[model samples]
Target: MTTDRISRQDARRNAIIQAARACFRDKGLHGTSMADIAREAQLGPGQIYRCFQNKDAIVEAIIKVIISARVEHMLAVNHDLVRKADEFTRSLAGIAAFDSRDDALLLEISAEATRNPRIAQLVVEADLNLFEQGCAMLKARYPHLDTIQVNALSEVMAVLTEGTLLRRHVRPHRPIDAQCLQSNYLAILHTLFPDTQSNNTRKKD
Candidate 1:
């Protein structure tokens, strides 16, 4: 009897998680309700509430899922990316696109943070952690760039990318795209490290 109860509970929990992810993506964090999640999961509202105390809990869970997916994708960077800045940019940009669900939740989370101090704290911490990771990557590839320079560049990239994403998503027909972004970033890189240009590097093939 105990084993059967645990199995049922696990199933219900997984169902809610899966459903919440879909509902959150389809409906922004504010737009989604517990009832919507229940319908998505084919469960009753009580089932969602039983597993998650409230709508905030569901949003937190969805963000966690999306965050985990992003972290994993970021970890998959190719160390052999020294000769290929464009490839590295694509991999870095891919961290956000691990799933379309990520972009949806991130935009909503940004909005939520503006209204809630606790949520704002989470966003700050998460962005810092992610920026640190990006800085580490920069260190690995371009050890010549000092810590201060790395942090500065990472901050610039983070803000620019976020703004670009917001514009792209909210205005899908917008002229901005990742290629344009890469070109702009490369220009920055060229100015920042003129010494590292392809002509300066004997390794360029």
Candidate 2:
């Protein structure tokens, strides 16, 4: 009930989530157990259970953290891209370079979502949050576009970004060319905003 106690509780909960993420990345969702997470966090099962009722609760918390971070990043990138389209392409390239562990963890969560009703609901809620934030960013940038157009554009962007993440996990060995990534992103931007010019202007020799 005290502030210090609440802070400690939150810290412990976050530690559990981090441990669960690492364990999930290495052993996968089905392979991971609450005992594995407890060992990874260096905490006893009692402590973990004090914070989360079960592994599913921990998984839901992890999904919330991951999705919240992603939504924040996407909102920031969208704001910058409105000012300069080059930022958009650069953001995609940055995503293309995420750590393999992150790819694995996300893929694992996605796979689990398909079979688990609770995880499926969490994923759907997270996705809706993302879509709403994306829609707001688009509306702010392109006020001229109607609601339908903005929604469609946001959906396209989300699909493309998610696809990029999936591709990295599914084909870890395939090298993504920075130039091609940028070019493809630019093409998408150009299609969406035909009047806007990308800041990148390297003349082809």
Tens digit per residue, CA lDDT, model 2, 81-191? 333345444444454323556656877888999889988888788889889888888887777778999899988877777776666445546456766766667677767
| Clash counts for all predictions | 0, 0
- lDDT for each candidate structure: 0.69, 0.76
Top candidate on lDDT is: 2
Q: Assess candidate 2 and give its lDDT.
A: 0.76
RMSD of each: 5.1, 5.5
Clashing pairs in 2: none
**TM-score: which candidate is best?**
2
